[model samples]
Target: MTDKTVLTERNGRIATLRLNRPAAMNALTADMLSLLGDELEAIAGDKGISVVVLTGEGRAFTAGVDLKALRDSGQDLTEGNVGDALNGAARWVQQLIERMPQCVIAKVNGFCFTGGVELMLACDIIIAAEEAKFGDTHAMIGLRPTWGMTQRLGRKVGMQRARELSFTARTITGVEAAAYGLAMEAVPLAQLDSRVDELAQAIAKNSPGSIAAYKDLYRKSENAGLDAGLAYEYETKYEIADVRERMAEILKRLGG
Candidate 1:
């Protein structure tokens, strides 16, 4: 499925969603956010797709919300209606991606700023290209982030580093992002696509039902205390059927 702003391509059990606004650095306008949300919702219902990769068509994963679009809309921020609508749509997209049963990977090939960073945080994993740039420029633009950036950024990196990055609005290289625990890893720019594909295929090879259950359990555990998380995990394990059969198959494959 190809839209003017977003493109979706499926290869077997994996789907790739590309932000198509290369000239605009794949900035998220309100319309683009809505389109992305629709696409993601469709993917969530697709039982055939077990993995989703999100990237950009050009030099940026996304530059974040389109400031120019907001400006041109002549919407008064003080009134809050327009701003709230845009933020609400962006939030819905993030939540949809986060709650989807399929594993979502952010292929950060280039610039990822503000809302883009928030979008990446919502994914299950992020693999960035070495030359990719990341930043939170909300403070620099005289606006506070309406998305989950404030909370997610601090959680991924330490609060101190998050504070410095947001306050200074300084861009970090992909290498620095990995070191700071923002990205899973940074690879050579030339190998970014292949690396993401490899990881996605690895994930796709697993049992979809088990993977979905684990993804949901992990999300639930993140918010629960250790004791509660442990209890929840223990209880959830019984929910998966054919455990013994699957284990036997694994052992047989290993020649046990």
Candidate 2:
């Protein structure tokens, strides 16, 4: 599990997972995908970790799926679901990233295209270097997405923008991605790490119980009507272990 294709590092309450095929532009090989999933799975259950940042070791966040590697393995990329073709690595990893309890951030540093876009879309927050590249090339190869690309992309950006990018197979900078609502923000590459670290630290300071509930509630609200969503939000029962202590601390600070 400690192979170079994927690497995991921990700092206090935060965990960082890096894709490590720099030579191949950190292409998403089967092993890389599976290992990434394993790292996420472990973090999901780790009470110590409140956040995870996903990025690449070298130039790219990831160049996307390694089609050549899949072809060499006797898989038909043009066939049914690409996930199925790759023996479920694509679908599994992305799903794990999205479903995991920890808040996940995709720290897009460089080139991110096709399946790379799919992978990042699974994260709760995406921030990138302004110079980073992003595109959806599924149309270029006449392939449909099976890794939640179509669904998540449309949700991240609007359906119109998603279709435009997918159909054109055109590349856009991280700044453009932010404008398109694909990434929440983009900063100079030099500042990306510090910016992401700041964000992760802020999130880590929050009550884990409340944050987990928020994640679940927001996801569920997506499918419900306004009335139902509001009702769910109020009626939902989520206990914050630190609620009493936090309130007392605030009162003391205010000299109550």
* Winning model by lDDT: 1
Q: In candidate 2, what residue range of length 10 has the lowest lDDT sum?
A: 78-87
What TM-score does prediction 1 earn? 0.93
Query: 1-256, model 2: which lDDT tens digit per residue?
Result: 3447888899999999999888889988777788888888999999899999999988999998887786677765556445564448878887787677789999999999998998898888999999999999878877777777778888888999988998899999999999999999999999999999999999999888777888878876865888999999999898778888888989999999
lDDT of each: 0.89, 0.87
TM-scores for all candidates: the values are 0.93, 0.93
Off by over 4 Å in 2: 1-3, 78-80, 83-87
Deviation in Å, model 2, residue 204 alpha carbon: 0.9
In model 1, how many backbone clashes occur? 0
> Which residues of candidate 1, in runs, are more than 4 Å off?
1-3, 78-82, 237-245
lDDT of 1 at 232: 87
